[model samples]
Target: MDLSCSDQSDHPSRRRALAVATGLAAGALLPPAAATPSAAAPATGPAGAAAASYTNPVIWQDFADLDVIRVGDTYYASASTMHYSPGAPVLRSYDLVNWEIAGHSVPVLDFGAKYDLNGARGYVRGIWASSLAYRPSNRTFYWLGQIDFARTYIYTATAVEGPWNRLTTLSTPYYDAGLLVDTDDTLYVAYGNTTIHVAQLSPDGRTQVRTQQVFTTPSSVGTLEGSRFYKINGQYYIFLTRPANGQYILKSSSGPFGPYTMRQVLLDLPGPIPGGGVPHQGGLVRTQNGAWYYLAFVDAYPGGRVPALAPVSWTSDGWPVVQLVNGAWGTSYPSPAVPPPPRQVTPMTGVDTFDGTTLSPRWEWNHNPDNTKWSAGNGLTLRTATVTDDLYGARNTLTHRIQGPTSTATVQLDHSAMRDGDRAGLALLRDSSAWIGLKRDGGVTRVVMVSGLTMDGNWNTTGTGTDLASAPVSGSRIWLRANADIRPGGPRPGRFSYSTDGITFTRLGPDFSLGNDWRFFMGYRFALFNHATRALGGAVRVTRFELSTP
Candidate 1:
């Protein structure tokens, strides 16, 4: 790689004015001239028509605790998907700036029965931080992570779009683990928080052969986790995050198990979005042309944590430096590799008309959904999988990350099949959540808006949420919309609206203030749900799901 730092320009264009939104989610990095409104905060560097530059948080959707790797001319990223079935989403990119859904590493989150959400629950407790690695020697990709701090599970596939199969389940767990395959093809894992340890894996990359407690945090730095192990220039290094705050590096000239030295890579560097958290907790990669870059996530709550890309340069002292402008992390930087426009790429946020028999790979269930109860054809149909008054307890809710900074999602739903006590519509899914849907009760159908729903200590449904507004409706079909200002600050509210005809909508009820808690981690998402409080035979047909940003 062009490993030298002496010539790399950390200074971006002095004209770092935020441009208008690019175009929805995938167009986040495009120049404004070819763009429309987007959920992403605008690209902040030069807006020249031919300029090849991109803003930070290159992906405006939440793909938290991400790990990016490059193979040949292609780059792939796999991110955390707690409680979302079809969990580990694999994203592909030609140029590091723009990304699209390639497929998934985990087709179904089947770690336990609770994930089914039948009579149990698994919200905010499934897949957390994970490590994604490629083994060219074996022509395989391996995804490894611990579920709920239980046993560690490793999955392997020949391609990113996979028939990924479970390789093994280690009885022991490795939290926030980072995987490394040395030049000699030896496997290693660095894990733990507050204290760190390195483990060497057996030849097959399944069992732990040897382990060592390599380092301990000094308390002054508090804690460090989210590990990403790497070997460069004959030296062993481990990249870790102090979460929602900083990034650190541990260098071991010895081996993967180290007598290591430490250095701070970045700390509390302001994110591209104002009032957002720092860029940390992710991985690093080098473009085929040898440009090094760091792919980290910024905590942009309400919308969740999103990935940002920054150029990486090495110091004469042999440390990696994330380029900065005027002592702060810049909002935009030049595209690391100039490649042909994206191909066979599905936008992370866009319109899905449900024309095909199978749903797009971008859609994930709120949990391990009852696949037997849901189908997609003329429109996506979701049959009530469970009877529950609590939305969290309801099964078969399909969801996708919303666009960031700002975005809107609209869905056209045919609720004629909704039976008594059935609630079907669109929602902004989070811990403290809200929704606008058609509720059928006592032979009468009403359009209702519900808000202020919060989960309790055990994530059980504490309240059904407040009904902000309601009206008896005659139409069998209705349109629902959710407009969100997820940009960080105090109480950014996501509002709800509805329409009987598709032309206009009723913007009603008080604003549903977005949540600020980072512990929930997945952030807010736009979800389509239909559940019966009485029986399971009710269903809703979602004809269109259109996502837009402004």
Candidate 2:
């Protein structure tokens, strides 16, 4: 419905902050020591060890505007992309431990086509917190997507993976709508921060029955959004993300609209970490083991921007509380129940050496890229093609995974041999507009900057800079460090610095506050570009592309 500080203390501050949970776990204070770290399991235990289950966050990612649902035999979750390409990626998992990108909900949102905009690529677009519902009576699944600030539409199919049919577009626009199916088979649609509303949907999962009723959100968070329903023992629990605070749930004994009472802080900011913080979105997970847990996003500074999982235990009373060791959860938690002899695919650990062959999954382009433009063999060659427009507008560059905030990469450029129109460089990009890149033009490596790219295809820079030579370049391992800090009252600046030898470093003379523009762009990835009008002569070889956290 409506919208809305930080400190560096230590691990598990002595004090505790508690919100009420009525008729649920009432007045029960589960102190930090309740789930205290013990000698049984070391603070740093073998990741996913059995003992780790009792205390740790379960889901970690930038799954903003998160929505979780359980379909037949699987748990499906969809979140809004800050800057995700390829559309709204749906993650599927059998036990919530192992996750894989099953597919996208909408095949297209007309980024490059309808908009005629310069870089009209569909990496991540309008689709936000989409809700999935299965109408068992008709053997059908309903998917609702919100775009353009509350414009809502419904798509339905016989299966989750669709040959779907567009059902109807809602005249009422709600930002992030949550869908709930009542025990009587009545469908309730909830909007953000405003009066929580409900409506009955046609059995076919297409049309609506009548106008909706309004249930006011409790006056804790000014604008209440992200409202979902859960019927626990005849009580309707409305789980909502409380703007600035983490996820909280309210319970009522009556119908969808009721005089509900707030019960317990299911998940909140788990204190703070070195480069960033750990917090949860308003997402819940009920596992096959009859155990219920909460899934939220954790920012692990240069590492975890994606979603992470956390287990929640019910108190003797009906309330829920997140389990954390040393009073909080960390990244490596007990692995979820492995389905007897679980299929094991080792998680990718460190930097990938782009050794002339075999492109890694971590490597991705902004959009559908021409395969011929890049040569994986012969030392990662990227040829600059004709550029009628700046390469940033279109998807012609190459980028890799952002390991951490403070990481470094080195690419050998043979620009002296490069043709006139061709240009190649290493970029530290959050998006097209808020990025810093070093390119060799006219036989010199210059530092080019942009504050953020505009919809009209222009860049805003702090200053009119043409070169980076005045800055320090100490070694062969060129490094870019993104410092994450939180400030109160004022904007916390995310500082960017660079080093040539990977040892001695020099600040780029200014700090750039992390902007929302990158949310659409998402995580950091490096790219080699050749955007010259004429084809460049020599190929560019990117080597020692190692990322290290400073």
Candidate 3:
């Protein structure tokens, strides 16, 4: 990691100018290219490519309470968790333009018996909107993730994926705290929920010396929670969630923590809905093109809210404001279109006979993961481990990541050659509380659904009780089709189905809306599942996985 903040001139040749002119342009951070007609096209490649920019939020899957920060050559972000383990899930990006879940903060926050987060049992015990900061001098990253008032701990690591050191454990009533370091290397820890407060940290980046300063009079600006402060030029801008009403910002000078004043509201609302308003938490990243942009989450009503990015411009008065029109807000800007999706298609190997030695990233898990639950041998063998009561326990679960709305992943599972209680199928999981998947029980292939905020099986079926072998031999190949379909009311509910053969799929269950707008849940996520209740290890063979847009 280079500590040298070289002069902008050294990197001038590679940096492009903003093609479109704007008042708050960061200057030379964006490319000088003009906005192309394809600017409206949806993004398909890694983050940062102009082709990935959208007039609206492109990756709309529910990733709630998001806090993003740039760390060295990568941008790291995390959000609230309903099922993801290790407390908070962390995402990394190279140019702040592209982002991927590198891992989690405190990778394996091995709580063991200290916390038991069963479906309904452990609702929100996990961490929420956590703030990220990078200490360049030591090349260490700091994260302050709070799991409500019960416990609030800070951790640090040299690399995102690391042997993180758990630091001070303070009983402060602060929840959702953000960490910031200034040009002078001074550290400030700030939190906002009911009130906004900042405390100075010891020079070593550990321990608080002075009492927290109540920076702002607690103002209910709607979804105002994820507070982040950034310095542009000389002015310090305080950004926080405005809840459902939209995000708002405050400005200050003199120092990082400040006697800041309200500048401008960053987001407005669409007419009125059943819910009063919908706001989201987001962070700002300055592109190399010299454009200052803000990325935040927006509640798309009952459809659930996900992360979105918009441009932030400054007014003539030096006040920062979110661009708006007719009192409504959106995610567009007069700028060069994002580039096209990358042409490289690094396809997964077609050989998935799972000799029990290999696992693809396409395979996922619910809640937390236990490496011992499965093994790759001569074939893919999944053995059930000790879990509390339901599937979320350390055992009996296999999962995968959600590719896209129009994508499909097909796998060949030969259950006929297996034993009972050994279920191998596909699923889309968010947390332990809810998930819908397909499992082969004995000779009957069934669609297993779990919802209602508990790990209870509210839905399940057994191929009409008839022998599945009697039907057309769809072969051992199973197709897991996941796609979004807009109903008559405009709600784009994501549907998951499976086929014995890749050609014809049987609609396994009713449509489950993709987003998690429902209170007390993180955004939506899709994953594959392979679990077993067998005494001896059983093998589920998958021949291949083909992912493609419809």
Q: For every candidate structure, what is the RMSD over all alpha carbons to the true structure, in angstroms?
A: 8.4, 9.3, 9.7
Report the number of the highest-lDDT candidate. 1
Full-model lDDT for every candidate? 0.75, 0.46, 0.47
lDDT of candidate 3? 0.47
Candidate 2 C-alpha lDDT tens digits along 1-550: 0000001001132111211100001001111222212222212113433433433223322334445555544656655542233344455655555554555555445333522223344333455555655555566655666555436677666764455667777766544566665555566565554355655566554666664555665555443445555555455666655433456666677666666676646344553244334454446555444455455554443223445555576665466677665666555556554333233322323444466475654444554454555677545666654353354543346655443333344444433345444445655444332344445445555444434433421232223223323342222234544443322113545455556555765666366554433223244455555555444443455554554444
TM-score of each: 0.90, 0.64, 0.72
lDDT of 1 by residue, 1-550 (tens): 1000000000121111110000001100111111111122222122222345687878888887777777666777778787898887888876767788877778888878889997888887777777777776798888888776678888899988888999988876787777776667777777776588888889897798888899998878876777777776666777777654777888888877788899999886877878777777767676544456777777778787788887777765557888886777778776664445435455667789899997788888998988889999999999998898889888998997888888999999999899999988899998888999988989999999998678864677777887889988996889999998988875688899989899889986888889876656677889999999988898889999999877
Q: What is the lDDT of residue 21 in candidate 2?
A: 8
Which order, best to worst by TM-score?
1, 3, 2
Expressed as tens digits, the lDDT of each residue in 225-269 for candidate 3 is: 456655555556566554444455666776656777764464445
Q: For candidate 3, what is the TM-score? A: 0.72
TM-score of 2: 0.64
Please give the lDDT score at residue 270 for candidate 3. Answer: 48
Q: In model 1, what are the clashing residue pairs, if there are any?
A: none
